[model samples]
Target: MFTTNPFDDDKLREECGIFGVSRAETASAIVALGLHALQHRGQEAAGITSWDGHDFHTHRAMGHVAGNFDRDEVIRGLPGDTACGHVRYSTTGETSLRNVQPLYAELNSGGFAIAHNGNISNAMKLRRELIRRGSIFQSTSDTEVIIHLVATSSYRTLLDKFIDALKQIEGAYSLIVMTPEGMIACRDPLGIRPLVMGKLGDATIFASETVAFDVVGADYVRTVEPGELVIVTNEGDIRSHRPFGETHARPCIFEHVYFSRPDSIIDNSSVYSVRKAIGAQLAIENPVDADYVIPVPDSGVPAAIGYAQQSGIPFELGIIRSHYIGRTFIQPGDKVRHLGVKLKHNANRALIEGKRIVLIDDSIVRGTTSLKIVQMMRESGAAEVHMRIASPPTKHSCFYGVDTPERTKLLAHKLDIGGMQDFIHADSLAFISIDGLYKALGETKRADIRPQYCDACFTGDYPTTLTDQDDVVVQNQLELLAERVV
Candidate 1:
């Protein structure tokens, strides 16, 4: 039981990344390229489904997109001018090939393929009701719940049925659906996840991030507006529909902090610029004197640069990360396995020795990696290690597609600022204030104005009703009562 990157275990992970292209000869290839750019979002499995007019072709595998989808044979088999794909990191379902996307099914309307990027908060409750109504399930994925909803919909037209299903569901979803009619892309009312539209020649493309379009030489058109659905007909007619009433958009704020690529443009602002702004705001709020500013590596780089520039402290690579680790490698014994952190990251002792340092990271979830990284800095002879987190302390769990640890397990939920500082063994630890985070996003405090993005993980102000979670609580109480009777 060797594994993927052990260092990533402490961070929040997005559940899926999706890409689709309509009316293009190179649809599958372009989608594969887009998924490659979004590989950071999900690494467990990859899938692609393409419709060749009369029939649908699909290829799915349990691994990264490069090895599975980059092959010519795989792309050749999926011959279609309309296609969509998904890369998954399972949160609501079992991790198996059966649960991979784009989850396709033959329906009365014709072949349907869907790639989903967010969770359905009421999926469990809906699943129970659907099951009782005799809708046999093929996979345990929440995404399949939508398929069943569409199948059972009594609305006359396929589009009408799809809209009816969307109205019944709650919580976040950015979906790219392919059908015999054409391709459809949409976002949830609150837009708790991200989805973007793009163009390459006359072809229409949809992806989880704008960076995806950049990869395949496509021009970004715009973000698919929250609660809005855009449909592209096989005959190439495109139309927009707003089934849900106008609602305040609440795109995930963490996208600017960690989930999205630095080069991505989110909400008309550069993600790199926003992270740097977050770092600058953090520096203003929690200034500390140190010899050099160090990033945790990769995702933390942009913010670190911002903190450094604002604080007038030189930025240096105090930690070096190795990117070539395999998904599963030979772990000889406990002693060797215990050195797991060293496999992916190492303390740059030469730069760290005898120096006081400031370490910048995107966020501290469980604080396990933070504690380990601080320990590494100490062992490398650093006099002091001050940890600065770019986002507000994540005290709540996210049910909207992110794989967040339970609230009880979150380090911020269990400990106050001082307690967490002590737990991680850093000289000091400070996360950006909630108000400061909004400032970085060019907004006032949430109390002064409507929230522009979903900061529920930090503030616990979830915008939607969590029916499945409530169901779980009721079920737990009933089970306890039954035990007492027994």
Candidate 2:
């Protein structure tokens, strides 16, 4: 029986979401609403840890934000002007409350709390080292490693301690740290994930997506640049710093294809528009002789619209997603995982029956789900499932934040296009070219400032490495990622 993980679950795994509030009177309440916007990223566990002048208070539960923190008392319990919240889908540790984030630690230097997005590649090695040095762990999450590092650092300054700790660990991270004085937001150098900063009248907010700022009525400031840090004080003084190994600002390309909301902007580009352009490019590159175009649904809808417009084929909603189904149950078994898929999506026979359909999706990971999806389309009487991926093949795993399959499990790594076509039982299959992907991102001008695309999953140039004994890999593909930022 296959275990359901955020990275390998039958249904899509929500990305991790983070929210940090500085100088807000109702920080906890604002965090709750922001978490709601980012709920799309993670659904397994929710937590908020706030630091008042005196101490830090934490409220965490193992469910959606709505269920875990729906009550007034829960939010009310976490009182503070500076706060940080996390919604997690456990890419590193088991899905238990013990691993849920916004990890609060009372250090000898002072009291502080941290909420982190993305995964650390060197967690296992670091954890073992910490254990040898008398660091006891309260949780299995790689996030806790930061706490240990911070506690053990010899640096006198808090920021220096933070920087020292960050230097030791490697991988994708957009961290929101809360202290009695202020809040600090930091993003990794390679920029494999998205993190943005915003502000209201007298408050500052940091989130994984721009939509969270809109939800909390905060004015969008800008994205926290790769390898940059923003520190906000209770007096409303915001300081920004960048201490990183030199690397290109290659934010995850998949963000535009799937992870980001269509409305959210990453690296100052509209996600929805970029995805549409990808579809349009796909149509130009691989014009299939099909009657109609069908989106995989939800993520695929916008791009499919672009594909339909560019391909001159009628866009059809050939698949429907069921929003009511619960993701997990008391039982942790294949039956539950299978039931989860059934609850999540189904084919629309009326729309797809006997149709010469062109399928548009963001990308294909393992051959299992895509293969199953192809079978569902065939069962719905799709005459020819001509699959066109919006992005190129994900042939490598992400050492950053995403839960991609290992290099070996990736179908693209194992099979050629023809092999994949046969494996998925599709009549025709074509993926967007790397050039086409850059064009979709609107790289028309010769602007060196915009950063290069990290097609690691497509090109096998990972930002970080997994040479250490840790199950997780560091954020930046040391050699490649280091050069990009430098």
Clashes within 3 Å, all models in order: 0, 21
Per residue, candidate 2 scores C-alpha lDDT tens digits across 100-131 of 88888888877878888888888888999999
* lDDT values for all models: 0.91, 0.82
For candidate 2, the 10 contiguous residues with the lowest summed lDDT are 1-10
Please list the residue runs of candidate 2 whose C-alpha ends up more than 4 Å from where it truly belongs after superposition: 1-14, 245-247, 329-342, 444-451, 469-486
What tens digits encode model 1's per-residue C-alpha lDDT throughout 44-150? Answer: 89999999899999999988998899889999999989999999898889888999999999999899999999999999889999999999999999999999999
| TM-score of each model, in listed order | 0.97, 0.90
Q: Which residue ranges in model 1 land beyond 4 Å of their true spot?
A: 1-3, 330-332, 448-450, 482-486
